[model samples]
Target: SQQGEEDPQALSIQEGENATMNCSYKTSINNLQWYRQNSGRGLVHLILIRSNEREKHSGRLRVTLDTSKKSSSLLITASRAADTASYFCATPISNFGNEKLTFGTGTRLTIIP
Candidate 1:
């Protein structure tokens, strides 16, 4: 499957704590992106890391990519209850102008106050 696998399917943490999620893929990819979905509804794009990039940071989020190992990790620092959601890693599928995003098995996070 082109879709990757995310570890620790679920996590529960206290507010202000840090949350981390890991993903591993099987094949080569041009880029990797992370998203958050609330209540199984809309997805909010968080970060994108290209194959050439080893790491990136945005606000409270940090993303790391290791193409050599075909793995990625997302870290959310000082998480809040509002951060509770299901997070997914996505890669692209393309063919002759046709492109689609394929998502990995997601990690559900719950933050308690």
Candidate 2:
């Protein structure tokens, strides 16, 4: 089974609005990371929140984790059309020397021009 899944496979919003997405996963992980991908481009790391961390923020992005439920949430404040892209969450295996990350199908976010 895949480790992570993002709800609302698709999201559409107007410019300047906020966007939020939820991710659920199975199994334990050392850390989870958020990434953004633009068309024909590689994914860029947005934030990495460890299991011990409940919340983290970077610029307009906020991420919260609930280890008890193996879930996480991402909040983006002041969205822009530039934010239009696919968002993915990755759960890195919890073990020393582990280097693999399982990714979610992703949520395609659309911001109106």
Candidate 3:
């Protein structure tokens, strides 16, 4: 079962502007994680917000989670060209007796320089 999915398959923004992406999930989650990946590169962890938390910040990244709505949003302030990448949201799921992370489809963000 797919747990989480990001809205807006793609986004384009001007450098120094702000970018926002959203994610929605199907079930309860202990925490949600956001990740970034450059073209042909591995994914890098961005930020994680727990179910008990409403918002979190890291660097220029701000993440907000609304467990009641089963949704989350990521905001990037002062976007730069280097920030061009695909963003994904992930949630841990328990299948059978094991736990694994399920990632969303992703949102491709392009920063115009």
* Residue-by-residue lDDT tens digits, candidate 2, 1-113: 75699987999999888999999999887789999999859999999999899999999999999999999999999999899999999987645886788899799999997
RMSD in order of candidates: 0.9, 1.5, 1.0
Ranking the candidates on TM-score from highest down gives 1, 3, 2
Q: For candidate 1, lDDT tens digit of each residue in 1-113?
A: 78889988999999999999999988888999999999989999999999999999999999999999999999999999999999999998786878788899999999999
lDDT of 3 at 47: 95
Q: How much lDDT does candidate 3 score?
A: 0.94
Candidate 1 residues lying further than 4 Å off, grouped into runs, are none
Worst-scoring 10-residue span by lDDT in model 1: 92-101
List the candidates' TM-scores in order. Answer: 0.96, 0.93, 0.95
Quote the positional error of residue 41 for candidate 1 in Å. Answer: 1.2
Clashing pairs in 1: none
* Model 1 TM-score, all chains together: 0.96
Lowest lDDT 10-residue stretch of candidate 3: 1-10
